[model samples]
Target chain A: MIATETALALQAPQLMTTPPLLTMTGVSRRYGDVVALQDVSAMVYPGEVLGIVGESGSGKSTLLRMMNLEDTPDTGDYRLALPDLPGNLFDLDRFARRMLCATRIGIVYQNPHVGLLMQHTSSGNVAERLLIAGERSFAALRGRAREALDASEFPLERMDARPIELSGGMQQRVQLAKAIALEPVLLLLDEPTTGLDVSVQALVLDTLKRLQRDRAITMVIVSHDLGVIRTMADRVMVMRRGRVVEQGLADQIFQDPQHDYTQQLVHAKL
Target chain B: MTLASLTKPWEAMSYGFLDASAKRELRRKMLKAIAVPGCQMPYASREVPMARGWGTGGLQVTLTLLKPSSVVKVIDQGADDSVNAASIRSFLSKVSGATETWDTTEATILQSRHRIPEERLRADQVLVLQVPNPEPLRPVEPNMSVARQMHADADYGRLWLILYEQIVRSGRVMQGAAYPSLVNGRHVMTPSPIPRWDVPKLHMAQHLTFLSAGREKRLYAVPPFTRVEPLVFSDVPYQVEDHAALTCHRSGVSGYFMNEIPQDDGSSAFEVSDSHLGIKTIRQAEGAAIRIGPTWYENGKMPQ
Candidate 1:
C-alpha cells in the first residue's frame, strides 16, 4: 500500500515546478469595527502543508475559512488557481461556490461534533459527501465508503456505529474519513486536535500525516500548538493581532527566528 | 316572509357543488400553475360538502373539470371500493352527471389519494393527486412566506441536509413516501404522499399531473413531458419498497407494487396495490374480454 501511494505521489523535482493551488494578497475583513483580519497574505502550493499558528482571535480561522471559500476577503486578490476554473473564486456566484464546496474542498473543525453528524453511522457520514457529489451506484458507494473508513483505521465491525456512541478519538476519526472521502483537492483543518487527550491526539495526528502523504493532498491547518505545526507543517506562518509576524521553512522558523513575536513563540514552545 | 320565500324558485345546489364563478377562478389559477411547472399557485378553495384535508383539493379540481360526458375515476390508496373513494366517486357523478370508472384507461380525469395507478395513463388522461402538504421546504422552514422566498431563489440545497441526517443515522435515506423531487429543474416539489414506487411514473410522463391542497390553498402542476426528478445523492439512488418479485396472492400477477399482509404463520402474503388491475387480470383469466393497458414497469423493472 505504501509502495503504491509513494509511486502515485511521485515526489520529484516536478512538485517544485507545479503552481500554487491557492494564492491571496492583502486580504482584510472586519465586523462592525472589530478587525478579525487585516491585510493577511499567503500562498498554498500542491503536495504541501501550510501551518498558521496563533493565539485566539488572531484571524487564523478566518484565513482558513477564506481558503476553503466559506468566507470572502473584504480587500484582497484571492485566486483559486484550479486549471479548469478562471478568474477569482470570490467572484463566483452562490451556486458555483456551493458546487466547489461539495466537490473540491474539505474542512475539519476543532470540535469533532461540529464537523461530523453525531447521529450518523461512521460510513454514512463519509458516504453523505460522496452522494452530494453525485455518486449513484450502490456498489460503488458502498465500496468507496468502506475504503475510506478502512483508510482512517475505523473498526470495520463498528461501521454502523454512530459517532455519539464512539469515543472522542473515534469521533475525530470519523471526521477525517468524511473530509478525505471526496478526495478533495484542498483540505482545511481548524484546530483539529485541540481538545483530545495527548495519547489519542498522537494517534489521530499519525493517521492525518499518513493520509496527507499518501493522497498528495494540499492542506492548510490552523492551530496554536507549535509541536503540531512542526510535526505536520512543511512551511509555517506565525500570526499575532491579525497579521503574519513571520513565515518560512519550519526548521528555519524554529531554529532562527527573525521577528520578536516569532522568537517569543518559539522560545515559549521550549 | 313565508309567502315571498315560497313564491321564489326552489333550488337545491349549484352545478358541480362549486358556483360557476368559483370554477372560473380555479381555472385561472390552474392555468397559471401549469404555465410554470411545479410552482404552486394559490387559489380560493371553496367549501365543499365533504370536510377539508380529505382529498378536498382533488375533489375541487375534478369538480371544475367535470362535464356531462367526462369519465372520472377515483381511488383512495389504489382501492376503488374503499369508503372514501366510493363516496367521492359517487358524489362527483351525482353533482356533474359524469360517468364513473374504476379502470385507468377508461377515465379522462383520475382523482387519487396516496397512490398512483399501476397501469400507464394515456396522454389524454389527467391525474389529480390530493396533496396533504405542497411545500417541500416546510420541514426546514416553517414560515410559509420564507419558504416561498426560498423557492423563488431556488435555494433548496438545504433540503439535502434532511436526507443527510437520515443517511448518517441509518446508512440509507429512510423517507418512504412524499419524496421531495425537482420538477422542470427549477422547483423542488413533494410528489404528494405517493409511495416511492409510484414516483418514477411521473417523470417526463406523457400524462399531466396536478397536486392540490384545499386546506393549504395551494395547487401545483407537473405538466406533460416535464422532468420530475427525485432529490437524491448520485451515489445513494432512490429506492422503492421491495415488491417487484413477489406475486399477488389472488390474481397471481407478478412484477408490480404489492401490499404485504402478514399471516398467522411466520410468513407474509402479497397483494397488488392497484385493486382494479388485479380485478382486470382475474377477469381476463376467467375468459372475460378485458384489455389491460401497458404498465409503467415490465417484468419487475421500469424500462429505461
Candidate 2:
C-alpha cells in the first residue's frame, strides 16, 4: 500500500544514467498465520548501497531473503535486471537461478558458520565461490583468494588456517572476501556484523565499505542496527510491522525522519 | 520323539539362494530406481552367504535376477580370476545352475567391484556394481537422515564444496573412485568405486547399471540413456586417469586404463587393468581366433 516513500531519493536524473538492478512491487510473504512481509516495494540501483533498517521481526530480513531468491514472494512482481538473464527472475528454472545466484550475486550470512565451511581454510572459503563459478586453475583460485583476502585486510599468514582458528572479525572478513571474490554485480548481506563485539564491528564495516567502493557493486544490507545502516547505506528504508514507514537518502532520513519509528531509531542511535 | 521327528524336516533351499519374496522386493526396488534415475531407493538388503562388504550387494542383485539361462560374470577390480570374483562366480553358478563366463560379451548379468569392464556393455547386459558406501553425501553430511533430506532438496552445494576444496588443496579434484555424479540432472549419485575413467560408460549408455550397497541397505540405478554427469565446473572439464598413453607390459596393448606396478628401483610397470582384455589381446596376436567386443574407449579416448 503506498504508506510512505512517494519519491525515492536516488533522483530521476541519476536514475537515467543506470537502470535499477533489482525491483520488487507489491511483494508479500506469509508463514501460516504470520504475515512476514506485505506490499513492500523497493528498487536497487547500480553501484549503490541500500539499507533496510528496522527492529527485529519488522520484515527487513524477509525482504532481504526475497532479494536473494532464498524465499519467493507469494504474490507480486520480482525482477532482476541482469544483462545475461531475462527481466523476470521467477520465470527462470532453478538451474538458471542457481547459476545467476552463484555467478552474478554473492551473499554473506549473519553467522560465519552459515557463510563458511568449517573444515575449509580461511582462504579456501574465499576460493570456494570462485571454484563454484568455474575457475579451474588452482593457481588462479589461490591468487584471487590471496588478493581478496588482502583486500579484506586479512593476514596472509593465516590464509590456510581454519575458520575456528580465527576471531569473529577475521571470520567476517573471510566472508566479505568470498562475497567480493567473484566481483558480483549485486551483494546481499544479512546482519553481517551483529554477533561481533561492538569494538570489532567497525573493522568488518570498513572492509565492506572499501570493497563496495573498489568493486562498484550494488549492495543490499538488512540489519536492526541503525549505526550499521548509517555507516554503510547510501539510501535508507525504515520499516515497521512488515511495511515501509519511511525512506530517503542517508542524510535526509537521519537529519529529518518523517515517520515516528524512524525518528525514534535515529534519536536512540545518536 | 523319533530320531527322524527330532531332526528338523529337510527343506529344500530356494533358487538363487534367496526366497521368491526377497527377489520380488529387489525387483520392485530396481523398477522404482530405474523409473527415478539416480535416486537411491531404500530396500531390505537381506543377509547373503558372503560378508557384508565384499560384493554382498552385487551378489544379492545377481541372485535376485539369476536364472538357468543367465550367463553371469563376476569381476573383482577387473580381474576375472580374482579369489573374490572366482568364489562369487562359482557360488552364483552353484546356486542358480547358470553358466559362468569371464567374457564381457557373453555376460547377461555382470557384477563388478572397483572397475567397470573396458568392453562396452551391450543393451541386453545388466551391470550390478557392488557399493561399500552408498551415500555420496557421506563426506559432506555424516547423518544419513540429513543426507537423505539434502538429496530430497537437491542441496548439492556441500558436495560441490568438497570438490572445490580438493582443487584448492591438491590442485585437482582428488576423488579417485566413487566420483559423485548427477544422474538425470537431478540426483547426485556415487557410481560405486569404479574409477573416473569408467564413469563415462554409464552416461547415456545402452546397458542398465544398478549400484547396490547391501551393508547400507540402499540401491540406485542408471537406466539406459540416462545422463550420468560428473560434478565439475564448466571451465574445469572432468579428467580421467592418465593411463591412456601407457601400454600394457604383458599384452603390449595401449590406450586403455592401466594399473601401476611399482618396481624395487622406482621404475613402474603398467598393465591393462582389464585382465581379460589383456588375455584376449595376447591370444588375438597369437592368431587363436579370439573375438574382442567393442570397447568404450577407442584410441585411448571416449569417442566424443
TM-score of chain A of each: 0.91, 0.92
Clashes of each: 5, 0
Candidate 1 regions with alpha-carbon error over 4 angstroms:
A1-19, A255-270, B1-29, B32-53, B63-69, B90-106, B118-120, B133-190, B195-204, B213-219, B225-272, B276-304
State the lDDT of candidate 2 residue by residue for A1-270, as single tens digits: 234443442233344477777877787889999999878888888888999999889999888878777778888777778667756675666666777777777888898898897877888788777766767565677789999889889998999889988899998888888888888888999999998998889888988888888778899998988889989999888888888888878898999897888889999888
Error of 2 at A124 (Å): 4.3
Error of 1 at B17 (Å): 5.6
What is the Cα-based TM-score of model 1? 0.77
The best candidate by lDDT is 2
Interface RMSD (one decimal) of model 2: 4.3
DockQ of 2: 0.17
What are the Cα lDDT values of the candidates?
Answer: 0.85, 0.87
